[model samples]
Target: MAEELRIRSNGDLASALEDYLAEWSGRSGIAVEIWALPGQAVSRRVAQAVYATVVEALANVERHSHARLVSVAVTTGKAGLRMTVSDDGAGFAVDEAAPNAARGLTAMRAHFAGVGGTLTVNSVPGGGTTVTGVVRAG
Candidate 1:
């Protein structure tokens, strides 16, 4: 499950991530909040991977979260890159009861796996969903 992607520079990655959020995340009528660390830092490969996962998670939120408020956040440190996309909609079980239900999370897992990273999805059926990822700095 290796995903091959061109590594983008920090500035380019930052811009790309923001643009992706603007076009894909916010346009869906779900509010988005971005919190990125200031300064030129971290690996672009990891940044892109994290950004892709965030966008995908937000996409799922937009498509199904039924939530008016969806939040996307990014944080980086020597520990690694952390991102969370959460919504206030009624959530579903992470179990595979239906096909494609977890497709986004699956792709997210693969995306991070391709970079020696990890993806975590938490959902409470009547509550909401939260997808988080952590990829080590390269």
Candidate 2:
């Protein structure tokens, strides 16, 4: 990921993410369906934040979700940049104070906050998990 980011600095974010997802899917043997990605370029800070959040979200999915499929979406509009990573896996109780889960969530939130964005996570024991982030347009 560091190499990819270095090579893609200030380049096409969508393309870079697509490449990374493809590689990740192949290695993890987990299917990833990218629903959307912004076509235009975004600031380096926003791009890095979004990419890092996605990476963290997928890492959690691989480590805990026990999911067969994951879906990702990112878009830029008047409201700003929005991203969502959803997994069809064995979701856990969101209210439970699990140490590892808390740490991962905190890291994800920090990544977004660094870019002046906000992150939200939603999950149900029997359902799935969704990590949503939004960065309002400046």
Candidate 3:
């Protein structure tokens, strides 16, 4: 399953996410939008990390956030290729010390770190959430 989910390019990643959102759109009130910037090719390994990060973040939004809309973007810039997933929903405080903090987010952080990348999440009660994962090409 993991092998099948490997992303080959930004466009491919966007299509995969669109399919995922299509499957989940009916289950919740949220609508998903994806934007992929035209640029360089992404390595399979880095794409995989970005893919997983988006998948996990979307699942969280579907299950917990009663958000009306979610936006997913993949862009290549001077820093690197970055993926951002944002949702307008009731957010929760990000507590790294909390027991629940070590689950998905921790795993995502580790995944990005392995590829010389970083993951950042911003959320506050009633302020919505945005998760950004970045990876540089070697």
Output the number of the TM-score-best candidate: 2
Better model by TM-score, 2 or 3? 2
**What TM-scores do the predictions have?**
0.79, 0.90, 0.81
Clashes of each: 0, 0, 0
Model 3 scores a TM of: 0.81
How does candidate 1 fare on TM-score?
Answer: 0.79
Residues 33-107, candidate 1: write the lDDT tens digits.
665632346566676677667767877887787977777777766776677778888898777555344477778
lDDT of 3 by residue, 31-134 (tens): 87766642565666776676677777888898887888998888876678888889999988887666356577787787789899988888988989998888
Total residue pair clashes for candidate 3? 0
Error of 1 at 91 (Å): 0.8
Clashing pairs in 1: none
> Which ranges of candidate 1 are over 4 A from the true structure?
1-11, 37-40, 96-102
Local distance difference test, each candidate: 0.70, 0.86, 0.74
Question: 1 or 3: which has the higher lDDT?
Answer: 3
Model 3 lDDT at residue 69:
91
**Candidate 3 Cα errors over 4 Å, as ranges:** 1-11, 27-29, 96-100
Scored by lDDT, the top model is: 2
